[model samples]
Target: MNTTPVTSPVSNALAGWLATAETRANQKNEPAWALAKRSHAAAVASSLAFPTRDEELWRRTDFGGLPLDSLDPFAAVTPARNIDDLPVLLLTRLAGEGANTALVAQTDSEVVYEQTHPTLVKQGVIVCSMDRAIREHADKIQSLLGSLIATDYDRWTAVGEALRQGGAFVWVPKGVHAEIPVRLMQFLSGAGRLAAPRTVIAVGDGGSVTVVDELLSENAEGASMYLGGTELFIGQGAKLTFASLQDWSRNVYHYGNGRAQLAKDAELQWIQVMVGGRMSKTNIWFNLDGEGANAFVHGFMFGDSRQHFHLHTLQRHLKPNCTSDLLIKGCLKDKARSVYQGLIQVAEGAQKTNAYQANRNLLLSDQARADSIPGLEILANDVRCTHGATLGHVDSEHLFYLMARGLPRVEAERLVVEAFFEPVLERIPLESLREQLREEIERKIG
Candidate 1:
């Protein structure tokens, strides 16, 4: 019960919450070093200015409006659902295909499933719950988790670490290439409560794997909240394809973070399709660590009504001879607002790296708002980097021509959206998945 005094009640309460999480971490037998890392991050995050109406970055999104700290809907663990309809079957085929990859899955509350493909098992791949990874693979787990994107030691993130409940852990063996994608799904049920979905995947040198994370709701439009995070580490010469689909309940407030580290000659491809959260903020970071590394990021969002979706991307080039490219597009209507922020960075010694970033948006109505801010930071003299952002409305001429051809406004817009999204969705490697994803985005637009 060691609590220090703070200036604001909100800050004080936040401190108390962190203390509680630390106590739980100790109770769970987390090593002193792990707890120390959490404590240090908490301090730094707490000191940062809280977004208010005054801050330009958050003004458009309006965090001061939500009662984020008072939302006490979080639970420790959730039980598995016995269901008839399985999620995207073929995605599961990767796991059933024989373990060239290890898989770990935790629902809102508990570790519902885990598997190490038979092929991967024989290769010494270890995929299990993050808790187990922390406990058994203590040394490895300690080095990666929480070391990526610094979690803003807020009520939401503390709730994430304190009641983590369950999450996946993937470790690929050096030189092994997974033939399929490992799928992880989190479905919010009636026992519906706040869920923090966390996942960490590490690829050994020359190894490869694909991971799919799905977030959906049980009550078809139920109200829920999810604070989720993901991190990927690609060993030198490895490859990884990570897809994140945010389809939580329409009433859920979601904040998500995805990150990756690319070693020499490694490749990372990331895809994000945000369709169902009531309000969401997405932040993704890619760090290039070795020469000849590459990263590609693509994102699209369709939001309507009061939905507010924001995305921030950072492509950091830390080594020479790296290449990274990003393309993000969003469409909004019915008073919804969307935003995109992209920044590309080249370190002092990151010479010979080529980087590019671009963001585009389509506004279908006067009330719908879209923001695009693309920036670049170059520290190396010989590196090449560029960024671009565009925000515009559907061309009236295009709309008129479509309508003249007997297409309805909705259908016409659908066509335009499809065209705009194709550049991003086409990059999805799996055909079946690509089709289903296009269908989902179409439905959301409708």
Candidate 2:
């Protein structure tokens, strides 16, 4: 690891925060192993320099305008007293009526609430805060944490891994199948505060589970920042469905890294939704490391005002007879901008691999901008790979036709926008989640 210290807004702030976190960890008698990981992560973070616009991954999204120095990494803020106090629509979408699911809610830096169904516990499923898991389930935690997306993957990842105060850990034992989803919500509150959350999920052989993770804010205040990471491990013949929704305040800057590893005959369905934030960048990666493994990755986003969103995805096939499909869609209005980059890679000896990727963007305003880039890397001869991207404005004829049907111009345009996303939305498995997303998209378009 690089040992030379760097001087920058992000690095300096993180260094100061690391010291405070270490002291707190010691005072709280946290696990030594967890603390050691944080210490190592801090060193890695200190040695690296902040990302700049020159980097290919960050070339289109500039973070220079962000007021990073003003944010407080260890700020103390109160979380919502109860789930009832949260946005009704959001809670409804997550917990549905009479749903028997495990739920976790966090604010700022700690998990304020957690609950798991009795049957799930009886079946040996574990769902709780990462802190608790680290202490009580050290064996399981130690085996997977930092195994996929290492703590030192990047500067922000290091910051999150070292300083994250709250998150969730979910595990489904062998042959156990969870009928309902596991839900986690992380809400940011107070101005100038920084929120870091980490999530780890593991599904045992022949087990199945679904997860819904959300990032939201209490209210729009001064500028804030959120750094988060998620890792998913699917065992042989296991199935996992994961969905993540990000809806931070317009004054917040958000960065996230999500990754998944699939074993032989395993299946994974992943969905990502981005709708809020002043500037946001997220990377999603999937590795098919076992033969007969399959995955489907989907993403949706709507940006208005001056918000900016950058989303990148990678699908890697490292074993023969594996397949992966990916689709990302976005709509931008006003002066909003979006950037999407996707890659599909078939490693050597990974024959009979099938991979597909596509990205589509719709610009609602002349001032709106969208950049889409799709790439492929194939080292195997008997592999099938295809990628494509499209950037276009809303169809004027479609809008005019709707308007002529006695609907107002705004309503007509809204309908057109909804129709454009119908294909992607229909792909979602959960009916409640699909409807909730549709409602949110409609609300945003209006």
Candidate 3:
């Protein structure tokens, strides 16, 4: 075990690595087009300071007590076993289980496995490794790839763009709906290394596609960190359904976000499932530029044993007749804590916009804590925008009712909490998935 001991953010090792990363971005042989992206990303990442107590978001969260000095990235991870026939976690619910869904798997910044079902491939559906996309369809991919979450400023975002490897690039051509889903999974198998994960998805006019991104640590080993960022574009009258399952080891750090655009009459439904990670932060934002666009988003998170999961969602309505409703709820136990902040924005000309956001949490123990903030910004007088947040301990009355049924105290509390969350889980739309997620939560709480 190479326990050199992790260092603080200010360590000299991190400084040197940052410098080298900049050099790597500016190297020759790199096409001129990607040159600016790498250079700009490097420059931004070079000056990034670790968020501190002074920062509103970082004040409450700590990065696993890292050293005051920066630490070097760990060795790259490798898979020990093949995943040819593993039961797909959430995607198995779709019609064409393994036949129609495309898959892209990667480890330690290297694409280890990538396969697209031939049927979907022939449908003009593009599902392949992002690295390959950058090489084959550079022009089309480059134009819309990072447009949502531009790496021009944020340090982490820049690092992800500049050093990103082993991710997926998906494009659904006009009027084509993959009757089956296209799935992308990332496995961080290397020892304690860092993986920059990036995903770019573009849906053409009247096209529809469902995508699921799953991140897991192979065999639940290693202390790896994955910084992932994704961009989504839904063209006019298109529909895009995106779901993410993040289940890393308990000692890893995971941070990511989704930047999306919805053209006229485009519809997007996004669901997020949080199962693991010692500490995680996720940010998602949607631009409702097309009239009659709709976004239905829901999130489920479970935390335990000093784990922390923080999420922030932004809904931006820039056109009339756009509608968005968000519901995110979580449960905490074993000294774990989490926060959910949702923001909804309606522009001045976005009359008739309907935006509603809600976040609720149920803490199972006194030691567990949850903070929720739901906010709204409306500049249109004719818009209906509402936001609400609720934080409370497990319902004692519900527990009492369960206990009255002869259930033990611990069991009663668990039942009540489960009952409280079933409404949200039931909305998942997939039967097997809904039940499977229910089991995961049951296991988590028990």
**Which structure among the candidates has the greatest lDDT?**
2
Clashing residue pairs in candidate 2 (N, C-alpha, C atoms within 3 angstroms)? none
Give the per-residue lDDT digits (tens) of candidate 2, residues 119-207. 88888899998888888999998878777777767777887887868889999999999866788888777578787878899999999
Candidate 1 Cα lDDT to native: 0.74
Ranking by TM-score: 2, 3, 1
**Ten-residue stretch with the least lDDT total in model 1:** 82-91
List pairs with backbone clashes in candidate 3: 7-67, 8-67, 8-68, 8-69, 11-69, 11-70, 77-189, 77-190, 264-290
lDDT of 3: 0.76
Candidate 3 lDDT tens digits, 1-446? 67787765454655565566556545524456766776666667666755666766666666645432322343454532434533343234333454445777776666666778877878988888877787788977888766788775355577676666557899999999877677787766534667787788999999999887777765444455777889999999999989887877685678797888999999998988887987898889999998999998888788989889999899999999999988888888989998887889999899999998888888878899998877778888998888887778877787788788899999887777787677767655456567777887888887
- How many clashing residue pairs, candidate 2? 0
Off by over 4 Å in 3: 1-12, 15-30, 67-100, 218-222, 427-435
**What is candidate 2's CA lDDT for residue 434?**
83
- The TM-score measured for candidate 2 stands at 0.93
Once superposed on the true structure, which residue ranges of model 2 sit more than 4 Å away at CA?
1-11, 77-99, 400-404, 427-432
Clashes of each: 6, 0, 9
Q: If scored against the real structure, what TM-score would every candidate get? A: 0.85, 0.93, 0.88
Q: How close to the true structure is residue 430 of candidate 2, measured as C-alpha lDDT?
A: 70
